[model samples]
Target chain A: MIRHPHLRLGALLLTACLLTSAAPLAAHAVGGSDAAFVAATRGPAPGPFLYLGAKHMVTGLDHLLFLLGVIFFLWRARDILIYVTLFSLGHSLTLLLGVGLGIGLNSWLVDAAIGLSVVYKAFDNLSGFPALGLPRPDPKLAVLGFGLVHGAGLATRIIDLGLNPDGMIANLLAFNVGVELGQATALALVLGPLLLWRRHPSFLRFAGAANFAMMTAGFVLIGQNLAGYWLTTGAG
Target chain B: MTEAIQPMSARRMAWLLGGATALAALITLGAVLPAEFNRDPLGIGKATGIAALWAPDEVRIDPAAGQQPAASAQGGPIRTLEIAIPLGPGGDPAGKDQLEYKVRLPRGGAMLYSWQAEGAKVADDFYAEFHGHTLAEHGKMTVAEYRKVSETANSGALTAPFAGIHGWYFLNTSERPVTVHLKVTGFFDPVAPGAPGNEAGLTARVGSF
Candidate 1:
């Protein structure tokens, strides 16, 4: 019989938390702001968008946190692929459609929603839904829905900048590609240690604590968004 | 011996998880702890690698008449003004080394002016005046005179009109260092047009060293 020890699970969880949190500090040192590069490009710059997109994804904290939460419970590679695909599909559609359509929403609200998405995922990981007797929302649908909100957030930022449209479509596509690349890179880094740690006996023991920290972070993010909203609009 | 190692009991697992969680929290707290103690304003932090050279002096805008107006037409009457002199290249305070002059206006206006370093690549933009009074009370101030002189096709001198606030944005693109002087005239003397002039002159020296 395959035996899993609580101590082994704890150790695994500890390693995962350390790796995940440290990834951003590492990526930030390499790529500070891809947005600034996109802004600087005057003409049809060669693959500027792709580079910018990758940089943004790598540096974006909210996106990373959400990804971490999604993969936290999944022990199998297939499950990771399935869930991530759902998230990607959801975000990509909104990123392309929202910006392309010129649909605008208050950024603060969108950010707040993004924060809530993190909270939701963390709670779901804790199996809070079954405990509360709530119907389990399809993870795929949830990912897609949240992706739309994320896209809206990106759209709002771009619209605010009044980006010149000369090569905007191409640039945006490049940026999206960059974002995907960055995401893939992050996944690679996260998954390697994760797969190894899962083999350890302590993975399950400390999983709850990591999820709790994520939930706390989610709350902090929501408060930040709400604070931003109040500062901008003077609304509670 | 190929004896299978037994899995930890559920209680033991819980304790292990709890310990890991506590450790994680401690690590995070350690990382963030210093920031709480060393609180600083945004943009003023060291991350940007830039600092303001000269702190802006308080600006005083006085009306030509001895009496301060209740308000002006635009929105409010003009009050005190504050101007900030950002530092320039070579790590020297832009206006600190030079002989600083404080120009007093007739009504109750005051201007704080500074000079830039020689051969410094800095914005020559000077903020003339910032009104602290209410918008409705201060009457609109118009520009009286503006002129410019140039030694070569690319090099030129510019004189801006006397308005509420004026900025001189001159770029020293020349290979040789260029010395440019800016003289701003006019203060808050919101009397009738025919009334005596309450013009005040504020000058700033700028160049590259």
Candidate 2:
């Protein structure tokens, strides 16, 4: 509408590349000063844990990609709120219970499941399931189900860090609150550009191409996680 | 207002799905597997020079991992070093001219060190705090002060209390600039400048004795 649709599309694609390319290039593990902070935390350090939780959610590419896929097509604010709430509810349950009970799954497998959620959402965006003569699952239920996997993935990382058990409840609660804060922040960032882009007719025209790219990203994530699993377990 | 979807033909959808899967597989084999896991099954990553992207610290070789020895009792081979710590103008009592230097020592590893300050008018014109700290855990640091005093020179021997960093925080308190020459013989590694845990950013001079 303004001019130079090709340039706009190129810019959008470039942005996508920058965002998704970082996932493979960077290790998903927590390290650096953050790891030091986690290791050095003693008891009841809610403020720092909260900050860490928020930081993790914001920087997490797997979570971001899944969120993007989940919201790519939804237009109504009410629907967005409902879907996001379901996701929050699902993830919160596992993040709290899994860590509290000291239950852990292989981090790689948990991440692989998270990647599969992205793939599922992207495929649904393309209506690929229906095209295959499969009954489409309720979007709300699917989001919630995948949210549980996402939460478990987060829990695995926290568990790996060996957080102190003293005042665990308060710290975990603070972290959860921080995660929600981070989710809101990330949602705002993602939604703003999406809303602006939706106004352009190019959105509809290139929607398929965009979704295909998302699907590819999802696969890359899955492959990376599975490879991590295979290599770490020495199953190769 | 109409956000209804347009369905692709079954054949088109199948092709796109297959194409996406194939492309993703190619990328994973060519890039992610090599860079993240160090397993380049297809060899394309090596051919394309993508495997070099794997940082040395991040590359984990699993087969020998369990069999590898624990953190070394001594880092590398024994070494001797003579280093200089210097301060320029304004190196005065306001604590402006401060520098920290450290060496990594394994638990119970010993080092004999002698350091002398020159250009200071007297012993009181120079100050140093010799200390050691355990690697931080959970953001909490445990510091052991071996000595904290003001003097122009000191000679000491230390068997490290823990496997961590032991160092000197030197301050030239005289209005005139002062330089301190330090000599050490020991089983220790000079903490590299700008490395993690080298919070002071003081560069080490690696003159062998």
Among these predicted structures, which one has the highest TM-score? 2
Cα deviation at A223, candidate 1, in Å, is: 0.7
Any residue pairs clashing in model 2, and if so which?
A39-B137, A39-B138, A40-B137, A40-B138, A40-B139, A41-B138, A41-B139
Per-residue alpha-carbon lDDT of candidate 2 for residues A65-155, written as tens digits (9 for 90 to 100):
8898888898989888988999999999999999999987888888888878888988899988778778889888999999999888877
TM-score of chain A of 2: 0.92
List model 2 lDDT by residue over B70-96, tens digit each.
333544566787877777644445554
Q: Let me know the TM-score candidate 1 reaches against the reference structure.
A: 0.52
> Which residue runs of candidate 2 sit more than 4 Å off their true CA positions?
A11-27, A233-236, B1-4, B58-209
Error in Å for residue A224 of model 2: 0.3
10 residues in a row with least lDDT, candidate 2 chain A: A18-27
Report the C-alpha displacement of residue B29, candidate 2, in angstroms.
0.8
TM-score of the second chain of model 1 compared to its true counterpart: 0.23
TM-score of each: 0.52, 0.65
Query: TM-scores for chain B, in order?
Result: 0.23, 0.58
Tens-place lDDT digits, model 1, residues A21-87: 5312311211225446555666555476676666667666677788887887676677778878887
RMSD of each: 13.1, 10.1
